[model samples]
Target: MSAEKTPGISAIDTTNFARQIVLDFEFAPVPKQRQRRGLRNEIIEVGAVKLDYHGNVMGEFSQFVQTEYTEGVAYPVRELTGISAVDTAMAGPLYVVIKRLSDWIGRYSAQVVCWSGADRRQLLTECQAKHIDPAAFPTDWADLQTFYTSIMDVGSHGCVSLSDAATWFGIEFDESTGHAHSALADARVTAKLLKQVMDGDYRVSPRAQEIRQRWGGWASEPRRAFPRSAPS
Candidate 1:
């Protein structure tokens, strides 16, 4: 669904910070043998949406990065992200792609928002591997997944997937732009979800509420240890 038709999001407020960036990454799947050889999944795609304080779309950035996988993109990864080896083969190197992304973000004082902490971790790992200065990217990063869980008082220790959270808020994926797993699609959805939370127009599911109540709030109940049985 379009942002205008998204529920729980009202008219722009035109207050708060200057801009916020919603970001997502797609990683190439590493085989078990390669993983054993100290190879980690490399970022194949980067997608982001820049929004104003009022949640209006300012701009977007999307790029694909070539990977070191000589065997070409893994079948599963290609299937999941719809990014083929040909795509990465024709794309720029990781360092080049990241540089372009940093340049696109410019000197604007904007906070980078991602669906979860994993994206930040992945970025750090890749940057370190490429010897690219992480400082090139915005340091002010926020995990929207954590924020959503904490605010909804549900799954605070874990997280709801971006698509699941969107579904909970009656937000539909705009397939015309991209599919569910595509980085851009996910980032766009995340932007919408963030707007809903900021507007305080989202709802916590009844099931989530019931689960929290049964668990005596959002905190997890400690497991009771059974005493060892005496030998008969």
Candidate 2:
């Protein structure tokens, strides 16, 4: 991690800002749309991506979590995420995945971005549900979702979806990058979309500045605890 103090409450070079940040998440299996969403939420794939300034893709971290079903409940994640029973037959347990995620984060620095609190919430809540410590999400991260909202001007609508953001920038949206419900894939896409939306040659400076300015007064951290896994 860089030793620089965060340029809090002011817009420093945003590219520099993003470089200092990291994105966290887990992809809950998205089965067939609204119908299968609940079933797929059982065990999600966890992942994260790091980005450096100048819009460089740095590295990625992730692991698959094998949920331990309740007493009489058998997890049918195969149909939910399209991962067959054979695929998860050999996968390790939930604790192992959480440990891997913790190792990936190492010691946290500030600047973790979530489009909304969704990914952030998933990581923390799921960890808790599994009896894992959730501090892996540090106190230094930034909430781009909230920050984006305050400055976006809210034109009868709002900032685009991550996928929409890609489309808005004329970048091709690859569903394959999504990993169905693999957390790492989701993180990579989010990181890629953020880079595409904020970087040069493709991004508009005024819009980028709008995002940065929206960050003002927004905190670099939150103290609330994540709710445990919701009904799936």
In terms of TM-score, which candidate is strongest?
1
| Colliding pairs, model 1 | none
lDDT of 1 by residue, 92-155 (tens): 9888988898888888776777887777777787677566787787776677775555544354
What does the lDDT read for residue 149 in candidate 1?
56
The Cα local distance difference test for each model comes to 0.69, 0.47
TM-score per candidate, chains pooled:
0.76, 0.57
List clashing residue pairs in candidate 2.
Answer: 38-232, 45-183
Best by lDDT: 1
Candidate 2 error regions (>4 Å)? 1-43, 70-81, 85-89, 108-110, 145-154, 175-182, 196-232
Off by over 4 Å in 1: 1-17, 31-39, 153-157, 203-232
Candidate 2, residues 148-193: lDDT per residue as tens digits?
3343334444544554343333444357565433455556666665
Residue 89 lDDT (model 1): 90
